[model samples]
Target: MKIDEIDIRQGTANTPQRSHGNCLPYVGVPFGMNYFSVQTNGAAGAWFFQPDSPRFEGIRLTHQPSPWIGDYNHLLLTAIQWDDATQKPDLAGNYRPTEATFNAHHLALFDDHFNVQTDLIPTAYGAALNYDFQQLELAHHGVAIQLPDEGRFEFTATGLKLAVSDYHGGEDQNLTMFFELSIPNFDAENSGYYDAQNHWHTATNGTGKPLTLLLATTAATVACQLATSYVSAEQATLNLQRLQTSTSATLKNESADAWNDYLGRISVRDHHPAVVQTFYTCLYRLFLFPQRCYELDANQQPVHYDTMAKTVKTGRLYTNNGFWDTSKTVYSLFSILAPELLPKFLRGFLTSYQETGFLPRWLAPDERGMMPGNLVDSVIAEAAQKGLATELMPALLAAMQDSDSKSAISERYGRQGSADYDKFGYIPADNYSESVNWTQDYSYSDYCIGQVAQTLDQPAVAEKYWQLSKRYLNLLDPATGFLRPKTSDGKFKPNFVPDRWGTDYTEGSAWQNSYSAFHDIDGLIAAMGGKDRFDAQLTALCNAKPTYHVGGYEMVIHEMSELAAVDYGQLAISNQPSFHLPYLFDYSGHPEKTQVTVKQLRKLFNASTTGFPGDEDNGSMAGWFIFACLGFYPVCPADAEYALGIPAFDQVTLHLADHDLTLTTANNHEHNNFVQSLCVDGEPFDAVTISHQQLMTSARLETRLGLVPNH
Candidate 1:
């Protein structure tokens, strides 16, 4: 179905906008089970149906008047009971239905997960349990199930009885049984199912029992001797009421306030649901990290880490392990937009060090040192440059020391006096070729240390790593104009080709790794002789034939190749090295190329089913899309400014707590691919660069576009 054709209902108090389409309706938070179809417009009419039990697969609907059953193959009824005129069901008892009877609803035909694999059935039908049901219909509010046949059915009330008839029958005939339906506290004791120790369990009483149907039946028959005692309706109601009054209430209130603020900042001219979804999804992904660790006490202040008695610790927790890739973009964006969270994340890193004695490579629930680089250096330097105070300097220094001392390079560039300082900056391409290239990973780390040292006013230390930053130069073969592995005597390794994979670096060739000079583009350009030659080589690299094997256990290799094709000749776009490549076009007198490449990449890769071009590497690739679509990208994330790229939307309005920043594109379309002119708050600007501070605090950026290059 077309996304634009779907109707959206924001569900306000009185006036709610309702539309008819098969679009998914979401409430509460975006990450939860909020995507579900509440209604449909067309031939179906107002057929009221709620997904089976929130925990089941059946879509139960209360039919009015005559029972109009459609294709029975699509419906799966787990349990059914009809209330005879004589007695009433307790309206709050847990009844277990037989598997055979339950499977009759077509739900069983699919997998246990209830994901329908086939689309053979157009509709379904079932026997109507003719009983008086209540009707309370309102748009985007609670659903109404009406059964008018029986005397005043109290479906909405506390007590009701329904006699159930199984689809299967026998001679003895389990003819009729009472069915009860009531909403219980989702987290209460003995209230149906609950998650404990990462596994779900249903307690009939206060005690945990093996989740077996026969066991549950035996417990029900035996009474109090079984697991937890069954929770009463009054208790269940109180629990649910408490939950609704507390967590749900608070979330609803906060979400409402956020929504109001969001709406107030919306621009009528450029608003689109796709844009909103992408923006909000990006925002959602951003919050997935630096987890919510601060548990407020009764006074609403954050509690100490020690207070949770070792079960819960207070420090910093984050989600979405996209460090290697995200450090290039997303983290840089966060460092600008949300400086307050920087220290918390740093502290989290420190806590990780304290716990494991090493900074994590890629962290989720565990330490996955999947990627090559120690990107924390970039994050720390960016944070420091942006004026976010962190205890990262010492940690970075220690990490650098560890990396240096452990490297084969350090052993080669041995210092006569200090054993630790021996050959500290050199990595030999001899015995430790593989490890040496990996050791070159420290080049960026050293660059970061230089920034951190400069921030701390330690010029000597900064200068030391600044020289070390030229290690990429050490690997550079002036003979071939490619960054190749070097021997101990400072000679280029023999038989080095720019395109061959392996020996030169891991997963990438010299053509891809040659652009590792993002830390110093001028030095790299000079090393390449001049801007003209640099531009030519960059063009060659972008258009170069793909020689690397496309498929392997490592998906990053594939992505690196893709991204490399977009950057200054050498970017392995599908890999991490090429992340800053597109932005480098600005320095090479080709900012328009950056714009074109960014637009092409973003258009090809998005947040849909086929969104990512390669392995996400945590949220790194995702962050790239976020930054690119938002209009600018951090070329040297260690620095404080973002180089402009083509923006995906005509306008993007970021609604901050205190102010809003709107970016508007003019003369923008598929045909107009270059920036003809630009302005910030009507002030004419010649450059396409923006500072981190401007992005976080500016009022607006009005960009005038054109078909040709502005220069």
Candidate 2:
């Protein structure tokens, strides 16, 4: 399947808290610093685009990752019909939803009421926008740009210059991005600024204006090429001059070529077209985050503004990534396809640590630290295990130790209770809010530190963290088989409802979080006494009704409601917490059960506009789908192996770093869904796991499936 044929709207058709993948229709190069989406409705804040909305607000150049984190530097670009104010339509005119195209490389809109054809072609730092008003009867047609709430703009003969107020969680919140927009052949004098009072003033020169786009032009086409820079306004103008020479159509083709080069890395041959489309669509999402934030200077070197130190720094930098979301899947996948990119990202993050004095937990423009866990531990550790970026092992291990040894000045960076956790082995409920989850995640993070240490040949560091990794066992209530919160004196929380969402757990109840001991799955099962009891408990966790109360959260969040809506039992695949739950049965010596559960879970995803069954979380869930479709999953990312699962495709051709690794399934018909047997390189592979070494070598993986369970 072609990259241009993939519609980004399939993943982005959503609103806040609601399922159906709460993603924006992003149009940019993979891992671009900025993403562009056509905003049909502007009322929802960061949830600005909805495919069903009838209104065309503008094209929003957004730096928003999620509605939960909101937006930092954002602005709007819209086309206006310059008729008499009496005869002119509303500022936000009604448009045909059917007449707009939503895809990764192209965003084109046709508004008959305004007689405007607005099309946007995206690059990493800028975009080419074409606004055609050939059919409009008005004497002049113009483009209106609404600045951010605290931004400023100025107009010139060719185009304009503006400053986008930049902030998302850094010490230097007052930083700004300088932009140069090249829109030539338009009426320069009539285009100036709009005040808060809704009055337009013509100006050849101005500063600190809230709006820019009052223009009356005779030209049929208004061509705009916008570029931004953190270096200076002069650099911004130079950047625009370099890339704005092509038409929007030509730029769109160029962006499409870039995407094609990326998406063509892996392809599935001789599969259903819908299935093929879903595979490529997921691959598209896998590259959307950890956006490249630095640009080349006049000397052709990487430079980015250090938001924490309020200084321009020389180094590679990236932002808009949540390690909690990307650690397990995105990091692991990249280790296979692009081995070299991992070191670049890790070095960029190391630079962030040097500037900010801490490794980032979650970064938008800066550290937001929204989710639980210092998951970058897993990210760096996985890289170490895969031998992808061994050169950065020393610094990466140091960053992990730094985050583990000391808490940040604020609770949002590094571990929240690093000192306390090191002392108590578990976060006491009295001392922390989400102590249970904090404890659970810390255990896995400790394992990650050990992995990196072991790779660097630090045996003592490896041994100490390996024991610390099992700290989740301290909080496990053996009586209930759940990792319940324990008080300071080491007693489990008095009241425990397995369905009570978010009291001690992150987004789930006790049942969902109990089995997250990824490093010690065997030890966790042994803690439950054996396989019979463990199997029974894992089964009960799924068979129970998806019930909840306000035991933890004041009101039920959407995950609870989504679970009930899907009737998937307590196995909430709609969220990330439960992503590995279905596969947990494999640990209980029931690979057949894991097979059936994952196959049923596969039914929830399709190639429709609302493609995902739940929030894909920056490709974490899609990464799960990508793995499951290929007949395996890396259940524990800290380890370098993948647990087997039912393959969704008949033949998957993976373009790995070394050689092509093809995974084929015999009798992969819809009815023959269970994996009966597996073979690799014409030999019967009896093991339930495949290592990265086994995958990197040139080989063929073939599995036989049956309608009945393998058991």
Candidate 3:
């Protein structure tokens, strides 16, 4: 599939009540610093761009990875024609939602009331916007620039230089981004600023207000170039200067080519066109996150604003991602297809550790410290195992140790309840909320740390962390075959209900969170009385009702509702905890069940406006789909292996950095969901897991599926 064929709006039909992927129709290059989305309702707050809404407020400059995380340094640009004194300050024009283009690299919308057609083509740091208003009877046309918070703008020789300071919640509360906009044919005498209440100021420059720029132009078509930076206004100008010579056609073509380079890496041959579309759309999503926060200065050196230090620093930095989500799937995909980019991502993360004392958990410009565990450990460990960013492994290992040694003073950094976990071998439920997840995740993170340590030839350090990795064993309730919460006294907490949600677990019950022993599935199976019992428990989990008790959350969060909405029983694939549940069957020597279960889950996804099962966090869900569709999954990132499953398509070709790896399925039909046999490079293969080395080196994987189980 080509980049132009992708709608980029898959999984965008979302709301606060429920999430159908919770994704935005973003227009930008892959991993671009900025993204532009059409804002339909500004008053909707985080839920601003609903697909069905007829109101076209403007094109929004958004850095919003998720609605829950909100946006930072955002601005809106709207085009207007005749002004009404009695109307509100911000005007909403009508547009055909179905007619507007929501392509991956470009956006085009026509405002009916204003008689204006707007086109936006995005670059890495900025975008070119063309406004055509020839149909309007009035000669004077205006462009309104809206800022979410207090901002300043100065009229320049080209157009205007604007700066806005805004953030949702992070270590850097006062994050700001500078903007340089070039409008060659604007009327300086009529152009000015305005407040929210129709209070207009006739001045070339303004400061310390929630200012909105109203630039008037008599020209029928207005061409505007916008560039932004976190460093300074001068840097923003430099960013704009790079693209000044490029036209709309060139910008659009360049953006398309950039997206095609990444999206074209995977080519699928499926009989169903929808399957091909879903594959490419999901693939497109896998590259949108961990946006580049660093920008090049005048000397073409990477520099970024250190939000913590309140100054510009020399190095790469990235933001708008949570390690808790991405570590599960995103980095593993990167290791396979985009290994070249991993080193820079890790280096940027290392810079985060240097600026702050701890490695980042959730970073939106800076650490927001959301979720449990420092799962960047998984990213580092996987990258180390794959030989990515090898030069930085030593420093990355030290950063992991620093974060593990002590509890963070602020809630915005490091692992919560780290001291308690170290003392009790488990996070005590009496003191902490979601203690079960905290303990389990920390244990997995320790295993990851140990993986990195062993790779660096630090045997003693590796041994120490590997032992600590078994802390999940401390919380296992052997009787129920679940990892339950324990008090500081080493006794299981009373009133143990496996169906209960949120008191001890992160976002799930024991059924979903119990099998998180990623690095030690054998140990988990052994603790549950070996493979038979483990298999029985997993079977029961899938067949059981998706019932829940709102224990701590006191309400049915969207996850719970989504779980019940799907018919997968207790396997809540809507959230991250259950992402590897089906693959646990692989550990029990039941790859047939894994194959069937995975194929069943594929029914929940498609290529449409509402495509996903739930909130697709920072490419994590998309990454999961990508791996599963290719007949394997990264069940454990710390270990360098993928659990094999049934393929979703007839053929999938992965164009890796050094080589091409292809997977083709035989007798591929919806009913033939269980793998009958498999071969690697024309040799018979019999394994539940395939190594990273084998996948990267092998030429082809052929899977033969049948209606019945092989056993």
Candidate 4:
């Protein structure tokens, strides 16, 4: 199948109360700096672009990672054909979403209310927009540009330049986005600025208003080039210059080629067409985030606006990703398929450390410090173990040590409750919300830091961190077989409710957060009992009721609803906490249970308008689906191995950087999801896990399936 055949809107059907991926129909190249999505209802706040809504507000150039994180540096572009001069310009129209084209590379929408059609295609830092007003009355055809908040606008010789200072907090309060747009030459009298009252003025520039630029053109169609920058207006102009000579057709082709290159990396041959479509669609979503926050100057040197220091700095930087989510799966997938990009991503993290003194936790243009732990350590560890980012690991390891030694002055930068965790060996429940999660995550991150240290040959430092990595054992409760939270006095918090959500856990209960000791699952199992007891507990976890108690939250959060929506018992694949739960059986010598559970989870996902079970959260869920279908999962990012599962596809060929690695399955059917045996290049293999080195070097892996458990 071709890239165009895949709909970018597969997981767009969503709401704040519940999510089907909770994604927007974003039209941009893979990892493009700017994404263009048609906003159907801007008044709905973050839930602005509904897939089925008939209302078409305008096309938005958005830097929104997730609705929960909110948007920054955004604006709306709308085409209008108004005959009246006295009326206020309304940024609303009606359009059929069914007829509109919403592909990854391009977006074309026909507004019936305005009798105009708009086409858009994106480059890395710029995009081309063409408005066709041939069906409108010849008397008037114009454009309305609206900024969500305070903005300054200047009419350029060719078109216009605007700077918006709008954000939903968590960055420099004075943060601004510089934008420039070049359009066909028009009459001087036809363009002006609108005041706060929506009244027009004949001024070349204006500021501090709900600013909207109105431009009337004589031509039947208007072609425009637009670019934005975090640096300055001069850099925005340079960004616009790259697209000056390119047309919509050329840009579309370029974007298509860019997306095809990434999506084509993994080819799956399945009897079901929808399965193939879903695989490619998930692959497309995988590369949309940790967006490029740096741009090039006249000499083509990388420079970025440092939000914390509030100054321009030299180096690559990235934003709009939460490390707690992506560290589990996103970077691991990159290790195999897009290994070439890992070095650059690692450098971005290094630049982040150099500027801010601590690596980012959640970067929406800058650190919001959402979630628990500095999970970017896992990202660095995985890269170092694979030898992808060797030059930067030493500096990054030093930065990790800094985080471990001291806490940050600002709560949004470094480890939370750092001093207490170091003193008590676990974050106390009475001191922090989600203390169990913070302790477990920090313990895993300690393991990751040790991995990087070992790779750098600092054995003493690695041993120190490796020993500290076992801190999760402090929270493990032998009675309930769950990791319970402890008070500041080092005693377990009283009244332990395993099914309670929030409070001591992050987005989940004890059942979901207990087995997160990624580097020490063996220790976790031994603490619980042995392999037999662990296997029984795993079975009980899968067979338990899908219920949740709103313990710490004021209301039922979307994650709780998503957990109850699915029928996988307590194994809530709707969120990141349960990503490795299916593979936990492998450690207990019950690989067949892992295989069956994974096969069952694969059926919940597809390439539909509502594709995902919950918040996709920057390709984390997509990575889970992709890995599960491919028959293995990155159970622990710091480790160099993948726990085996059942493959949904009959054949999958991974086009790696060095060579092709194909995975095939025999007797694989709907009911036959248990692996009886495995072979590597036709030689019998008996292992529950495969290493990164083995997968990269091997050419083919064959698995024979049966209906019953091999055990």
Best by lDDT: 3
lDDT of 2 by residue, 558-642 (tens): 7777787776778888777788877777888888888888888887777666888777778787787887787777778889888
TM-score of 1: 0.61
Model 4 regions more than 4 Å off: none
Alpha-carbon deviation at 62 in model 2, angstroms: 0.5
Can you list the residue pairs that collide in candidate 2?
Answer: none
Tens digits of per-residue lDDT, candidate 4, 470-499, equal: 999999888888999999998998888888
What's the ranking of the predictions by lDDT, best on top? 3, 4, 2, 1
Per-residue lDDT tens digits of candidate 1, residues 560-673? Answer: 445444433445555566677777778777888888877676654533323444444433565677787777888788878888887666787766647878888887677777
Please list the C-alpha lDDT of all candidates, in the order they appear: 0.45, 0.80, 0.89, 0.87
Worst 10 residues of 4 by lDDT: 82-91
Tell me which of candidates 3 and 4 scores higher on lDDT. Answer: 3
TM-scores across all candidates? 0.61, 0.97, 0.98, 0.98
Error of 4 at 391 (Å): 1.3
TM-score-best of 2 and 4: 4
lDDT of 3 by residue, 599-665 (tens): 8998888888789998899999998888779889999998988999889888888998777888999
